[model samples]
Target: MTVLEIEYKTLLNQDEFNRLESRLAHVKPITQTNYYFDTSDFVLKAHRMSLRIRTFSDKAELTLKIPQEVGNVEHNQTLLLPEAKEAIKTAILPNGEIKTLLVQKGIPLEELLVLGHLTTIRRESQTSIGLLALDYNQYAGLKDYELELEVLDAEKGKIDFDNFLEQHNIDFKYAKSKVARFTSTLKKNDQ
Candidate 1:
C-alpha cells in the first residue's frame, strides 16, 4: 500500500522527554527494529529516498519513503519472516510492491544492500490534534530521543506542533529522519 504522511518531528532534550512522558497516561513500550538499505554509491540518498524493513515482534514490512511537497510518499509491502531474513542477509528485495516501485524508479535492485539497523523503544498515544510518539532510539553506538506528531493536515499540524513546543518551553531542533542520522553515523565510523 501507498500513503502520504504528514508529520512534525523534533529532537528532545532528556528533560523535555521526561516531562512530556510524565503527563501522559502509563503505557507499555513498543519496540521495533529497522534494517536500513542503500546502494554503496548512495544513489537513494541523492534522491532523498530511503528504504528499510521494519520488524516488530511478529511482523516485518518493507517500506520506501520518497520526499513529497506535503510530507513523504511511503510505499509499503508486507514480508514474511523468512523473506525478511533473506533480504537482510542478501540485500535483495523480495517480489512485492516495494520492489515494483523501485524498479519503476530505476533503482538498481542488485546494488541495494543493508547498511545497518536501529532499535527504538517508543511510547505513543492519540491526542486531539494527532498521534503523539516519543521515541528513544539506539543505533551506531549512539542514542537519542525524539517527539513526533503525525496528523492528516500538514499546515494545521505544523501550527499545533509549534504551539506544543512553545507551551512546553522547548526550542525547535533540526530533526533529521532516522535513516539519515543512522547513515551519517555509519559513514563517520567508516572514516
Candidate 2:
C-alpha cells in the first residue's frame, strides 16, 4: 500500500498554546477513545499515521485483524498469515481540514464481540495514543501506557525524530518492531 502523509515537528507549551487557541478562532479541538481487538497468534493490528501540509494536520489509522494461528507445535516455529480488516483512517489537510474512513463489515456487532474474544482496547487522542490487546480474561490483568510520535518522511523522519527527542530530553529505545507490536503486547503478555 502507498503510505502518503505529512508531518510537523514543534513542541507545544502552555503560553504558546494560548496563542494557538486564539488563532483557532471558533474551531473546537476534539478527543475520543476507540476499543479494538484481533485474535490469537497475530490476528489483529492497529495502524496510525500523521501528516502536516503547510498550515494543516492530517492523521490516519486502521485496526481489526484476524491471524491464522497454528497451535500445539513444540520446539519449532509457525508461519502465520494475518488479514488486515479493510482499513479505517482519518486525516486533516493544510487548511485545518479533516477526513475519516470506516471499514464495512455487516457482521452483527454482538457476534463479532462474541467471536473475537475482545483481545484489545485502545484509547487514542490528539496528544497521545493508548492500546491494550490481550486475551479477554487477561485484559484486566495488565496495564501499560506509553508515549510515541511518528514523523512521516521519505528521508529526515529519523533525523527529525532524534532531534525532537534530544531537545525534549526524551529517552527512547529504537522500536524493534512495528508499532502494531506494541498494541499486540497486551495479548503476548497473557502467556
Candidate 3:
C-alpha cells in the first residue's frame, strides 16, 4: 500500500513530554521498534528516502518513504518474521512492492544494510484536523520526545500543530526523523 504522509514534527524535552502525557491521560500508548536500513554509502539518504522494518507485538511491516512535493509518499508491505530475518541476513531489501519501487528508482536492493534501531512509546489521538501523536523515542542510549501531526491537509495541520504548541507553552524546534538522528549520532561517535 502507498500513502501520502502529510505530517509536521517537532522535538520536545522530558518535562514537556511529561506535561503533554498528563494532558493525554485518556489515550493508550503502544510500543514498537523500528529498524532502519540504507546502502553502505547511504544511497537512500542521498535520494531523500528511508526504509525501515517496524516490529510491534503482533505484527511487522517493511516500509519505504520517498519524498514528494508536499509530503513523503510511503509504501508499506506486511512481513512475516522469517522473511524479515532473511532479508536482514542477506542485507537485501525486502521482497515486495518496496523492493520493486526501489529497483524502479535505480537503487540497488542488494546493497541495503541495517543502519540502526529506535524504540518508541507512542500515543495517538484523532482530532478534527488530523492525527496527533506524542512519541518518546530511544536509540543508541539517547532519548527524546516528539510531537507529530499527520493530516490530509498540510496547511490546516500546520496551523493546528502551531496552535497546540502555543496553547501548551512548549518551546520546541523542528526535529529530524529518528533514522536521521541515529545516523548522525553514529557518525559523531565514530569520529
Candidate 4:
C-alpha cells in the first residue's frame, strides 16, 4: 500500500521533559528501534565516505552514520539514523512512483533543543531484509517487530511472518502489532 505521513521529534532534556510531562496526566519511558540493510554494491557518490558519532538522551544512546551520493528517485531505499534531526526520507521507483518511508509524527517544540544526525546505508543493488522494533524497554510498552524480505516476487510464497519469527528466535506470544501505538498514548499525553 502507498503511504504518506509526517513524523515529529521532541528533543527535550531530561529535566525539561520531566517538567513538561509533569503537567500531563501520565508520563512513561519509551523505546524505539530501527534496523537497516544494504543492497549489494551500494554506493552513494555525492560525497566522500565520512563517519560521525552522536550522543543523545543524556548519554542514553549513541550512533554512527555516514552519508553518500544524491538519491535516485527510482527504486531507491532509504532510512534515517535515529539521531538525525527530524528529517525527511523517501524511496523512488524507475516508473516515476515516489514514496516516503521515514516521517516525523509529532514535534516537541517547547522542550527539545538538540541537533539530530542523519546517515544512509549503501550496498550493491539487490534484494535485502530489514526490521524495526519500537518501545521494547518498558514493562508495558508493547514490543513491535517487522521483518522485510527482499523477495523476487511479492506473491508466490506462503511466507509465514509468525513462523519466521520463531525461526529467528523471536517469541511471538510476546510480540505486539505496533510499538508506535503505545508512544501514540504518550503523544496523547503530550497533547
Q: Which model is ahead, 1 or 3, in terms of TM-score? A: 1
Maximum-TM-score candidate: 1
Runs off by more than 4 Å, candidate 4: 1-152, 155-163, 166-179
lDDT of 4 by residue, 1-191 (tens): 22221111122233433343344324333333332211122221112211112223332221112222321112222333432323212211111111122112122212222211222111111122222111212213332222222332223211443344445444333322122333244446558
- Structural similarity to truth (TM-score) of each candidate: 0.95, 0.33, 0.94, 0.24
Quick one: best lDDT, which candidate? 1
What lDDT does the true structure give each of the candidates?
0.91, 0.29, 0.88, 0.25
By summed lDDT, the worst window of 10 consecutive residues in model 4 runs over 91-100
The better candidate by lDDT, 1 or 4, is 1
lDDT of 3 by residue, 60-169 (tens): 88999988999999999998877777666676765689888888999977778888889999999997768889999999999999999899988888888889889999
lDDT of 3: 0.88
lDDT-sorted candidate list, best first: 1, 3, 2, 4
Q: In candidate 2, what are the lDDT values of residues 1-191, reduced to their tens digit?
A: 22233332233344433443454335444322222332233222222221111111233232222222311111111111111122111121111111111122222222122112112222223322111111111123432222334443425555665564566454554332222433455557668
The Cα error of candidate 4 at residue 24, in Å, is: 41
